[model samples]
Target: MPGYLEVLIILFVALLLFGNRLPNVARSLAQGIVEFRKGLKGEPENQEEKKALPPAGGQQAHGIPQGTQGGANAQGSQPPPPAQQQDPS
Candidate 1:
């Protein structure tokens, strides 16, 4: 087992190496912990916010256009031809 002095030295070196990013690292770690706890309780992180927002009408959802939900290429456009490869002689 390492002594207290060895642990302190390791922590000091780590602080020096990550001094500038320590706060951001700590913040992200805290966020992860909160997310994990919410998951344990089966609670979504933004359920209330999602419910509060009004739905978007006549607009694309999940990148699919309003009338192109059931089929691909619903705009009557043809797919581009495959590129021709040249010989590397």
Candidate 2:
């Protein structure tokens, strides 16, 4: 650990370099410390887990239409048929 005189010298140098920007620098340093502690605690860095999972009800994951999959029709409705294309001469 730095002695008192060494700490004072470091603070003097920082003041000379940062001048009026010292408060902003200090704020950023404090925030970095907070995030570091959160990381050490294994906290999730984002809110993704707070988001709702896919409903327990549907064919959503398999690229199948919502109302048709595994012989189940969500709305008891049939999907529209693919259009027949006629070639133009």
Candidate 3:
């Protein structure tokens, strides 16, 4: 635990360094963190999870519409079907 004097010192340093910009910087940092986490949450359905979806790009597979693998554009409503992607290895 930080001592009272240590806490005061930290606050004084923050006040000296940030002055009036601290709140704005904190808000921006929080928003950035939220966006970053949203990105990091990864593909919603994942490439491995199977779900019923409409035919993708007028193409059909096994009597069902073939769909784009995970990541954005997974939904049939998205613009032009995303190109098929494969692992580099």
Candidate with maximal TM-score:
1
Query: Model 1 lDDT vs. the true structure?
Result: 0.84
Instruction: Give the poorly placed runs of model 3, Cα more than 4 Å off.
Output: 1-3, 43-55, 59-89
Against the hidden reference, what TM-scores do the models get? 0.46, 0.39, 0.36
Backbone clash pairs for candidate 1 read none
Q: Write the per-residue lDDT of candidate 1 for residues 1-89, one digit (tens) a residue.
A: 99999999999999999999999999999999999999999876798987876687755566666666756655646678899999999
Residue 66 lDDT in candidate 2: 53
Clashing pairs in 2: none
Q: Which ten residues in a row have the lowest lDDT in candidate 3?
A: 43-52
- The C-alpha lDDT values of all candidates are 0.84, 0.79, 0.74
Query: What is the C-alpha lDDT profile of model 2 across 1-89, one tens digit per residue?
Result: 88999999999998898899978989999999989998999887766864654657642765777545655545545778889999998
Residue-level lDDT of model 3, residues 1-89, one tens digit each, is 99999999999998998889989999999999977886798645444443555546855556543454454656655678679999999
Better model by TM-score, 2 or 3?
2
Better of 1 and 3 by lDDT: 1
Number of the top-ranking candidate, with lDDT as the measure? 1
Please rank every candidate by TM-score, starting with the best: 1, 2, 3
Measured with C-alpha atoms, the lDDT of residue 10 in candidate 1 is: 100
